[model samples]
Target: MKKIPETMKALVAYGPGEYKLVTDFPTPDCGPDDIIIKTEGCGICAGDLKCQLGAARFWGDDIQPAYVEPPFIPGHEFLGTVVDKGENVTEYEIGDRLTADQIVPCGECEYCRTGRYWLCEPHNVFGFKNFLNGGMAEYVRYPKTAVLHRVPKGMPLLDALLVEPYGCSKHAVDRAEITNEDFVVISGAGSLGLGMIAYARMKNPAKLVALDILPERLEKAAEFGADVVMNPKGTDVAQKVLEMTGGYGCDVYIEATGHPSSVLQGLKMIRKQGRFIEFSVFAGETSADWSIIGDGKELELRGSQLSPYCFPFVIEHIMNGDLKTAGVVSKTFPLDEWEAAFDCATGKYGDFKIAITF
Candidate 1:
């Protein structure tokens, strides 16, 4: 057995734009119902970047309360190996590989009682709360309330790192309720968007379109599943999509870019009775004409939160080589070089998903 240590290296976020690396941060303790694991890797998400930049959704404003707590270790897309289990923890052994859902739901909440734990009212997510410290460090503690899943012992690092994002992607695609006759357009070809394309392809939609401002990401989108790739920079995306659908527009439009423009673009390019799934963590509030929903398109707009119950399916597909995860994790950095990893994730060097290896 690997001996547990008292102190470990970690990257902690104090506030917006104030993340620091500390070598002597205390290792997390294992409660009677908790288990501790040695982290294998943690992926940097666009939401993490938004949190660092003090986006209104995370930092909050007069209209909304902040969702993030400072001085917390920030990473939810992670995988690890069990190193220690408390006396009351018997479901896992020391050598087991596992991961937990991002959110630690309160089982008594209305949403949790109704089998919708992802929408639990206090919504304490790992990496955002002090008590539920995340896997950006060398070791992490998983509480009993966590929804744990055993990862296959032989799963590749890239496939393992993709579990969280793909779970989220699966949930978002499921919200769209795509059919073989529908023309689906997904905006943003980032990690989440690429995963959405891959999962949506399994439904075999008539046309799968991907939109991004970056040429490199658009190329990667094609490899994943997009039948048509378009750049929104110079193209009239809504017009082109409308023309392709005989003036009706795409049957479903999923906004994953987090940019306000993408939301407006979806409103314009969706058929009158289409479903639009908004899954991005936007930097700020987006302004859209209400008429587009009520009088204009009569659209169905749905918001997708964290991955609900899709982890098992994602792990199974990835392990079976059904979900194409290759080239998605474009880079990996050591925990000490977290700043550089964040830079790559924010597109300084142009990346898909960036991981911090332990």
Candidate 2:
């Protein structure tokens, strides 16, 4: 008689302000439309912190009893290797290095048909409610609809984990229409903010000003190609941006901070016809006064959600050395110490992105 396999280690959220390492879980089995992957590395995002803090109502705050329930893994930004493939799947085979976009949109929805797939009603997330199992474990399963892109040869696994966030920033930069002659302002020097600074630098923006509250993060942003870094604590952010641009408001503004006031302040930093792109992913409601956007200033306001057209570009940059991430990755932790890693990222202990390696 054959014996049944049992047990694997995973980082699970026990409740608000608590995450415990669990080991009595079954390793995932492949389904007809699924492929199993061995996690290489995964990034800790600020949004993940919000989810852990009971702000995860998007998936229902209550812990339900089911195969998919709380005490579930909580990592969405991941990169891994395909270890097993289920029947009828031909796009990928065993041994492929891939990473997935967090949400797997339902392809039949009108929003998907119209290219706004991020709004798909019945969305699935690997690290959150829908999938319930994420890459924080030894393995993860990818459904047919997930946007799994192949990692190029020689690409660092740590940097691969950054693909999702980099894709998002690239999308925002595209929407802002940054140009060689345009002066651009990036609000927030977080991981996503630094990525925008890197992507915008590639387009040769006349000036790339990065605004943030932390001095360490600002210094890191400057190292990542920001023309100037400003700490809003001592200087008026809007005034500094205008002065740097010779009295003309910046030509483009990219807001990566979900803070309402940042978005409102962004409005005052852009030129009459400039573009403003909002790229922050917050779990709760974010509101800003509309009067700044009401007078037909001919300004353009765009919202860049999960990236739909940036994975390939991100890969290209990594391959060509244009998007060096050596400095972007500051620390790494093993699977067992995930709680400590999450705490560091949530507490803003460093100037770079935090990652977990298995």
Candidate 3:
């Protein structure tokens, strides 16, 4: 086996929207139960973008930039090959393909014991709040549990980079009980929303309504099997969705915009006794008029944090070609152009998922 480098390159964030490519950082050490992955592909997630700015809440306000220091890597969705493993790392060998979930939970936590580890308190997501060198770097180390599962055989590593977000979308759809005949509306054509669009197609919904402010994103949404794409900027989304669903509203609504107004729109677009699953994490409080759901409308509102037993399900779908994982990605960038990748991922240039290839 070849010797590993002592230092490697990575995209470091000092504060909101601030980042620089650094190549001299020390490679993180691998523990007895840990593995070091040589990243092949990384997906710039919305949450990671938000984390670049002070708006991100993954780490409490107390651990702001001043506390974390510079040279902090911020990538969570990624796929790679194992290059080195500690003595006890038996599940993976050198050159094995793998993808990792961002969150690492304490097995002793109440949420972990209850099988809701994704929502465990003090949950530290790699590249986000608690500060772990994430996949944006040339290499990252983590425990076996954080390494969700092996990549599908014969699947491209680039497509595998998408599994993380797709898992999150699956949880939302599954929690809402989406079905073949259900009319589903997804608010936000961002990467997360696009993942929802792709996975929702597997269920063959009666109609899929995609809402976004950008035409470019909506255009892509159509390609991903969205039945009708609506730009809510100048349209009455609630009325349009209602009319599209025969005045009954949609059976399921997934809010991925992380905007309070979008959440309200989701609440209004659900049919009485329907389900609204919030896929976005809107930090801070915003007023929500409960009167719409208070009058015995029998609405079910859910807050889906991340995938819970949905990772393997998404992997199977992608492997079987039931879900269009590759279609969801619109562009790719070399790891050196981390700034450009981050910008494109945040919809600064346009709408579409931006992937980083090493």
What TM-score does candidate 2 reach?
Answer: 0.89
* Comparison by TM-score, 1 against 2, better one: 1
Best by TM-score: 1
> What tens digits encode model 1's per-residue C-alpha lDDT throughout 1-358?
7689999999998988988998999999988999999999999988889988887788788999888887899999888999889899988998999998999888888999999999989899889877888889999999988999999989988889999999999999999999999999999999999999999999999999999999999999999989999999989999999999999999999999989999998999999989999998878778999899989989898999899889999999998877889899999999988988998999756699999998
lDDT values, one for every candidate = 0.91, 0.79, 0.79
TM-scores of all predicted structures: 0.98, 0.89, 0.90
Superposing every Cα of model 3 onto the true structure, what RMSD results? 2.7
Residue lDDT tens for model 2, 245-322: 777798888888777778877887888888888888665666766756757457788888777768999988977878
Candidate 3 — which pairs collide?
16-52, 16-53
- The regions of model 3 sitting more than 4 angstroms off are 56-71, 129-131, 283-285
Ten residues in sequence with the least summed lDDT for candidate 3:
62-71
Task: Please tell me which model should have the higher TM-score, number 2 or number 3.
Answer: 3
Give the residue spans of candidate 1 off by over 4 A: none
Cα error of candidate 2 at position 124, Å? 2.2
